[model samples]
Target: MSWKGFSLDSATSERRRPGASRVTAVKILIAGGFGAGKTTLVGAISEIPPLTTEAIMTAAGVGVDDTGGVPGKSTTTVAMDFGRITIAEDLILYLFGTPGQNRFWFMWDELARGALGAVVIVDTRRIEDSFAALDFFEHLGLPYLAAVNCFEGAPRYDAEEVRQALAIAGHVPLALFDARSRDSVRQTLIAVAEHALRTLTAGRPRP
Candidate 1:
């Protein structure tokens, strides 16, 4: 397949068996507000070593970046986080994590190109921080799900409460997940994948 003039192939040079199924690669985006755990989710679920572009926090961002809720955050994603996971023998997922800071938002359009869907990670402590990401995907008409990153010390709310707080549509899938848990992250990814599939199906012209 081709994305932005770049060709991407999941197959290798070696020959495959007569009955073997060809692998399919799908791109997915992990996006949310600052310090919402987009990077953590990608790293935890990635089968290979995750590629991170984190840079240390500095005085340069004093007034520009907001660190109120997450005072202990010492670094931020300067560009993007990249990872890969093989969901099944014939399916692979390429994860791209967008930088949470607003300054890097210009790159989101490029990162979102050809993406199947997105997972918007929300921190209950600062739920408002996620509104921008939610609005972005909604405006783009992209299929996305909301995942509440269960951070320790943050107040926990039921799915309905979060759904109301975010003002998301009833059809949008919402779930709780721990960014550090591989199993939890995997389930969230599966949910978004299923949601995207359903969305695409609904948009297709009936035969």
Candidate 2:
């Protein structure tokens, strides 16, 4: 869609509830490999219209960007996608979807600053494509969960099987979902928030 600048005051006014306590906005990053449905997940779950910077793929990117698994994909997210959702009367979530290509990964360090956690979306067919994202988050020690986006006609695997294939840690949350479904996306976000909160609590220093 169209792009516009974001402001805290404006976002608060739009998402605030009557007689609610002060708002707490938590930032989360949506990350994955190219064509893994990061943009679609944000758009499906966001209350406000999502801001996206997408450009049509051209011959120029043929050598640089790999399109082996997703040959039909014609567009790419050139920058981050922004969206907002209210989890409770006093709690809001700001979602930032990172650009998937390696070249755009430099922006992730900035996008991930102050983020409470992240969601790594995976395509079953291109499971290997998500390794970079997993490594990035793990290296930075950011709390995150893995979501397997069920694409049509794509091979399906159970959560445990996928987790083993990805070599995800035992404590990390892993789930299956369809990015296009609002309910599924919402559930996935809830899982991520729960996992993040647990990690934070566990890491707290004892009094």
Instruction: Assess every candidate by TM-score.
Output: 0.89, 0.89
Q: What stretches of model 2 exceed 4 Å from their correct place?
A: 1-18, 204-207
Candidate 1 C-alpha lDDT tens digits along 1-207: 211222233211122347866655778899999999999999999999999999998999999999999999999998999999877666678899999998999989888887878999999989999999999999888789999999689889999999999999999999899999999999999888778767776773211
Clash totals, every prediction: 0, 0
* lDDT value, candidate 1, whole model: 0.85
- Model 2's TM-score against the true structure: 0.89
Candidate-wise lDDT, in order: 0.85, 0.84
